[model samples]
Target chain A: MKKLILALSTAAILSVASGAAQAATKVCFLYVGSKTDGGWTQAHDIGRQELENHFGDKVETVFLENVPEGPDAERAIERFARSGCELIFTTSFGFMEPTLKVAKKFPDVKFEHATGYKTEENVTSYNSRFYEGRYIQGKIAGMMSEAGVAGYIGSFPIPEVVQGINSFLLGAQSVNPDFAIKVVWVNSWFDAGKEADAAKALIDQGVDIITQHTDSTGPMQVASERGIKAFGQASDMIEAGPKTQLTAIVDTWGAYYIKRTQALMDGTWTTQSTWDGIVDGILQMAPYTNMPDDVKQAAMDTEAKIVSGELKPFTGPITKQDGTEWLKAGEVADDGTLLGLNFYIKGVDDQLPQ
Target chain B: MTLAEAILLTITTAATPLLLAAIGELVVERSGVLNLGVEGMIVMGAVVAFAAAQLTGSAYLGALFGMAAGCLFSLLFAFLTLTLVANQVATGLALTILGLGLSGMIGESFVGQRGVQLEEIAIPVLSSIPLIGNLLFNQDLIFYISIFSVFGVSWFLFKTRLGLQLRAIGDSHGSAHALGISVIKTRYLAVMFGGACAGLAGAQLSLVYTPQWVENMSAGRGWIALALVVFASWRPLRVLAGAYLFGAVTIGQLHAQALGFGIPSQFLSALPYLATIVVLVIISRNRRLTLMNTPASLGQSFVPDR
Candidate 1:
């Protein structure tokens, strides 16, 4: 009698476990920095939460935050795959090759890579068009800058950052042809102290408005403390700088996350390259504040134009930094040129670090 | 204020944290203990300070809590290395790993939160003096503590009897033990002091430096502080100078980049470490001084034979 009862209980527990597993799709994520870094990784984390909210019991979300790039990333991805994660997301450009390698090892486990080009049969790539917002920020900076010069704190000289610089300059030039910008590269994506120091240096060097491509809100806080105008990135930083933030380019990835998770659960997930923009609800601008009414209206108009396909930020009668003509009048740059963008436009003051 | 004045003010802010941490580590090393967990202690302090300030609505209380947290954290290291006779190097490294992970967990809630900035305390009249006035006389509370700590540490190391006893213990712990000196007790006090200084430095980071709580906000500054002690040849005054030199170079490189100097950003970013070490190395080339200041029994585990 005892043996029969024990066996029956064991069978029941196993059935429940299997039922739970079959009911919920396990989705895992690997991040390059802390989930609360207030920048790139933080943005992804917010999106992850959206996945949980949208799917409820249909999906289970797990994440390994602060996972470094390279070999460790491979181990982390493989660990997730081995643990029966049906879908995995590797966020960061450096995770590209590792994601591919791990995806190959676990073909059954679907993978998504953020901000990369390569996509395998089981791996997909997606990124937001952040430069679209940069163009708006530059226009705002151009209009409001009292000194006619702006300080730009860039994280790295990657094509993404380069595109921001060029697009910003073009937008600023549209407002005031002679408006100039000084660029300072802090190298790392998020070191608050260094980013703050960069902001101070730019201000002391005579730039009235400050903007940063770095992950931390350090620069924004500095601009606030110094009583200067600035913009936020990745996430809304109005809390950090109530009076200082002109407008921020916020990465609102919740909509995309819900869409993807729904598709995954519906058995319609497919590998694709996605570079969504403001129109797709993937990227958005924080409310225009700390600016004149006309400037705010102008910014909104610019946003409308970009979203309506009336203004392409990279279109140009633009000159390279060396005074050589790259694009003739009204020549819109292809995605290929923008992806490989490394050169500075004509009026940028700082040299690009190779 | 002129741009130069602003730059000078920033230099002080940058250097104060390093100076505070290095001076404390110098004492620890002087007492025969090599606590490499300065980074760990500092990060814990930053998170703790930020959290306390957020809770209490007072940055001062947060700073006090931060220092206490660091001191208590070091006691764990002291117990393992001094009492349990664990390898000091291994234990110290472990302490750092533990501190980083623990602080990350503790600071999880504080992440993305803006910290209360420790406002500058301007000295009446003195702050108005040309050039040096704003840089020295007007600054945050931690800056004053950092300067006083340097003077206090230098005077204590050279003039005080207890300081001599501690140095004797560092040089030859067994000999100090034979003389009936409580080597473990002195080392504990020294280690705790070092931890407190590192904590205060961290408080400065979260309160005065960037005024925010992020995981690993120290960003290797503790390791840099550890190096500063060696670069200063364990001299308190030189540590002050070394810290400033590093801070100046770090700020200078940023200015240079803004000026469109065209230097490679990576090389420019590394300029602080290179410049600080080179200057300190050149000044401390006198091997006798460096050798004399270094504790002979540093990093050695002490087992008392009662």
Candidate 2:
């Protein structure tokens, strides 16, 4: 009788485990631009593929590309929900509201938004600390640039981009106190011609080193053509400018995507916000090139220190554009201030667009 | 390069594409066809040109392919509006939408791939001259072509008999038809010319401007070219002037920002469009020029009395 009871309990547990394993997790991704955009969207797509590779047949993934941010996004998300997507990842900041709206309607479905702030019971936000990589590029720019002037091509004046600019300047100032940065806001995320034109304009004005927060390889191509140095953003752009690309700040979303997908599969998914940096492997630096060994070593060291929390890009003794002390001496910047960063720090030469 | 020289060179680069597209559209509008699909055609030209250049390893061949693609795309519009009697405005809009979507699909694999840049043609003796040489002789083949197009278009429209017939059709299709001129045939040729020009403009973008493929790389240059046609009052020379003027404003704003003039970047970015509006207002104030230069049957669908 005792052996029969144990056998019955083992059979029940095996059935439950197999049942959970057998149900495939249907995951959907909504992208703001083409998957082959060669930048941000491309990075996310790569991560999605990595997720697929990691999970194999246990997971099924679907995605809709070029979904606009507003009402159309809501429709896309709702369609995914209606199609029985158990979890959806809206991979652009503009889809925050739509993701939340769909999450509310489909309470059982999980939603993840990238580079967003809002969250609910079923909605989670995730972002990588891209500024950390920008900080390292700043250091390299300050050292390598002949004119000590770097140009930054920004897509928008949002906190995210502003944070990167500030961190970059801070990194440059650390290496060269006299280092100056000129910023041009193209007011767009992916205008290749405008970005190239902006790069040329900056170079013409004595900017030798260029960096862009935009989504195209245009600036890097311009840098290569003009014989100037530049850093790539979001993806490794060495192919775009083999001679000019010093290093690239690559966004690695694969691990996070895998983690979240695993959580969903394990039935342990919950609403939470995650802001990870180099330590968590969300932000990665491409192999340093077009620089001396020592310079490359120094960049790698700085990256290591950032990951180890030994160096903070936005330490105090920082002055805002309006001549106000933002952080006290020796005090690192807090998340709140960083999240709402809108003003330029002291060494930047250009005015922040209001 | 001196700041002035740099600025001038930048302006030339900026203006050439607009000049090319505008010159072509000028002819189309002169033939009484309104095609707002220049943007789509330009983008199609850019991707096709990039792909061809990458595959063939020759920039010149890439440019030819680009022009051919544009001509082909414009042929679709001609078939719809001219033969099928579709509404020109709606058909043009549909063409733009279709072109944009189709280019994106076609360009998916070409993205992130760099193409060979069109080499600059430096006329040895002439290019040795100071500012003028660098401005004129030391330019790429496309730049020379764009300038030649200006003179060629001006001569064709004002000096040539075919040009007069095209203008007549634009002014009054009915009068031209009754005068024994084939209105539909002339319009078809003009539209094809415009498409070819728009394609060359796109090729200049991918092969010379940035020398790479990116979705929507043409940005709003097509619209700007369209606006340039209106700002120039449909004249070829004025189109050249307006394009360069807009280019100067564009580069000037960047200079202003780099100089740290304390102006907000947003306003600096807005300067180009603002200048466009101001120039348009100033030019449109002279209503006689606009009316005299304007095509009377512009945008009107000509269903020849069949």
Candidate 3:
């Protein structure tokens, strides 16, 4: 009787384990900022919600926010894996190395990193080509600036921020040749006070328009106070200073997130780098507020051309910071030239920090 | 702002947080207890202050709540270290980890609320005195209170009978106990005082420093305050000087980066921390200095009956 009972218990346990393994999909998200910052993390949270709403009872999602990019991040990732998270998404550039490291430890788990350039068999990368939207904002900024000067509040000296600044300058120069962008490095991602101060200093220097890559609406607040027009950064910040906000580069990660989660549920999850722009609907533009009809029409024309592949934002005749032509007329910029943009355009006032 | 004015303003703002925290830790150490829980207390204070400020739309009330919450949390440490007679250092470290997790968990709701900042309190005649005006008179009320706390504490420690007894407990708990000074009670009071100061420091961070509650907003200021205790050899006035000097390093780094110094911003940030380590190394190398100023019964677990 004892032998029969032991065999029966073992079979029951095995069946239960199999059933658990066959349950609904579990996805985990780790954010570098809070879920309510109305910025990058908030955008991703929206995506997560969209996925959950679409997947309904078939998907299970868990998220940890404000996880710094370091050993702490590694510990969080390991904990998520131990908790049986089958698919994980880490949203930040600094998470690149740690995400890859943890992915190796959990080969069966699929990992996706945002704004990072690392990959493995189970790890893939994705980023929105945000420069495309900045180009459109720059065109409007150039049309409005009386001083022909714009302020660019940058978070860091990374390639991503550099690309945005360069693209904004290029778009401005297309409309106004002598426009100069004054760059101020705040060295922080979400410091509102510093962002506001940087904007004020630029305004003091006769900059009539401001563009910020920092993840806050503080810069726009300062611009509004000073009666200067400004472009919004990540997410719609119209409420911060509706009068001053020109347009925003609305990052639509929800579409991709919903798509990816659906793919994971359907067993079609694959590892590949996905760079989506306006053409693919990942990088979008908010409506132009207080902009003239002609300015709005111009931006719309650029948008249409981009979506239809009739015009490329980074078209040729581009010059390096050292006055050397990187892309001559009628030549398209290659990934190498655009990826390694380490210099200022012709009209930038700030010296590039070494 | 002139160089002198800016330097003065920076010192006061920088010193307020450290000075407040160090004063509290000084009291804790004087009672033969070393509480590494300052970090946790400060973070809690930041979250509590931000929450209160957002609810009431008043920075002052937020600060009060912050201090009260901080003191309440410190009571837990006091109970464990003083009542339970557990190892103070270990308990303190545990309290910090608990406080960090708790603060982060509770601070989730304050991710984007703009805090009400305390306005600068400019004295009628003093604020108009050019360089002196900006330096000494153009600061918020917290700076004034921080400076006064230094002297207030010095008087309490050196002049008052209670202060003498507290020092006696640190110097030789057995004698103090024989003389009828309650070691546990004295240590508890000191620890609570430390908690109050740490709370104020945290309030400064969330209400004034960035005017928003960011996760780990206190950064390592609590640890820095602990180091300032060692750097100052535990004297109240010297603690003040050390706190201001450290603050100078913080401001100097920003100015250095702003001036386009070739050094990376990361290195400049690490400089102040590196300076603290160097100060510790030098003090440690000088054995005489260490033996002269360290509290006799620091980090000691005191059991009255045993």
Candidate 4:
């Protein structure tokens, strides 16, 4: 009688285990850099961590980091598909073409690309409207600056960087009419020395405030040492320099990552574009300790207004860097104009690099 | 500082890494062995240096490890060129590919982890000297070392008996062999020196220059270094000038865009590379000039029997 009871319990456990195995959901993440870089990949890794936290044993996750953004990316996606990944996320702009190529071959697999524009039946794209936060930070830079000169450590000459710079200038000029943003393009996304040197050169030229789109906190460290103020690029770099860091444009991919993974597990996954901004809470302001109270209060008010759709930072009366009227006063720019922003506004010191 | 001053500063820093590597390659080529694996060696050095620095928290030790790693990889080239007597160009190409793959694999863990950066050791009055002062002396120790190496190499090649012998071997291995100069030994020394220099360049990249290792971060700098050697016409001082010129080209692009002073950004971005090609064209304009300095035994099979 004892043997029979034990045998029955073992059989039941095995059946349950089999059922759970069959119900498991698998997800894959492809990264262009190491997750530890504290840059693009780190943010993506945070999102992946959220997926794992929310789903627990219901979902399985794997990632391939430091994959090149071109042909290699497509190969990585194909590998994931062959390895039974139910969903794959390719994170990088250059991965767009490769992601689409792999998506077509793996129709059964769901694909979500970060910072890409392509979409397919099984593929979707999502990117933060980071410029929204840049515009806000620009407002702060304008208000707090004793020097009219603001140094911008630019990463690339891509459309994304262009958009951010333009939005930043527009926001700054709205507050400080005399503000001039002197940009220094390092042309690399993650070179600390180059970023630091660019910041120093700007400071050498009498610019007191700085901002960077580069990944490393070396620039912030330099700024702190030089007794100048600066804003963080992608992540909150307060730890890198608490004194100099006025604020940061934080990329909070966790909520969206968790939400999307859960959707996949629940069988509600669908291709879609996500252009969330301050309203949806994906882009948030890091705690503003260095900012003055008045400046802080103004930023808070602007944030609230932006979230409520009551304020449009890129409103008209905009003129190009070359003095061309881009928008009449009170004229709001459509999504298309902003999407294809090919020029800078007035008061920008450098022309857009070809 | 004017735009020119800013551009000059950027160029000097940018050329530091390339100049170190090219000088090493110059020595290697002078010995009549072409080691095309500089890119690979550089990557290996960077990854090894970064990993060592991260573990020990010592930038100096990290640099040593990088040089050691580069030397270790150079043995493959030496073995192939010296013992097996393989085709120099092909062996060098294989070395580059191998170094790239191996370094990429090893660099995976070191990626994104910041290593310690080199501090500038500036001389008092030298660093304070006007425009030229900031542009030249205010740089880190590596820059001074690179400049010193140009004179060092010039003296070694012209004033010293050993330098004369090395040049003789490069000019004609047969005649040098007849004079009883150990062909294999001289070649090995040159290659090893080249390897060490490549390692230093890699160390500078991860330690002083960037302070981080990204996969394949050498990013064709090695190829450009090779071109600089050709542009320098195998002269050390000229190589320095070529490197600085390339550096200026690179920084000039960014400066034009930064001050948004009015040039098309993309065109500016491509200017440095275009400038390199143009310079190469001009250097080769007089076919006789290249023919005069071209090593007679370059890329040639140097078998004792031949």
Listed in order, each prediction's TM-score against the native is: 0.97, 0.95, 0.84, 0.87
Per-candidate interface DockQ score = 0.78, 0.61, 0.17, 0.30
What TM-scores does chain A show, candidate by candidate in order? Answer: 0.97, 0.93, 0.93, 0.93
Q: Which regions of candidate 1 deviate over 4 angstroms? A: A1-9, B276-289
On residues B73-182, what C-alpha lDDT tens digit does candidate 4 reach at each position?
88778888887888888988888888877876787776545467767777889888888988787877777888888889989988999998998888898899998998
Error (Å) of candidate 2 at residue B123 is 1.4
TM-score of model 4 (CA atoms): 0.87
Instruction: Report the C-alpha displacement of residue B258, candidate 1, in angstroms.
Output: 0.7
Q: Of all true interface contacts, what fraction is found in model 4? A: 0.42
Tens-place lDDT digits, model 2, residues A165-187 = 98999888889988888888888
Candidate achieving the largest DockQ: 1
* Inter-residue clash pairs, candidate 3: B24-B194
| Model 1 docking category | medium
lDDT of 3 by residue, B146-247 (tens): 888899999999899999999899888888898999988898899999998898888887776557776666767889899888887778998888888787
* Fnat values, candidates in order: 0.78, 0.71, 0.09, 0.42
Candidate 4 steric clashes: 9
**Residue-level lDDT tens digits of model 1 in B1-306:** 898888888888889889999999999999989999999999999999999999999999999999998999999999999889999999999999999999989998887777897878999999999888888888889999999999999999889999889999999999999999999999999999999999999999999999888888888999999999988878899899889988999999999999999899999998888876786678578878767878999998888877
Q: Identify the CAPRI category of the predicted complex in candidate 3.
A: incorrect
For all predictions, the C-alpha RMSD in Å is 1.7, 5.2, 4.4, 4.4
Model 2 segments more than 4 A misplaced: A1-22
Please give the lDDT score for candidate 1. Answer: 0.91
| TM-score of chain B taken alone, every candidate | 0.97, 0.98, 0.94, 0.93
> What are the interface RMSDs of all the models?
1.0, 1.1, 4.6, 3.8
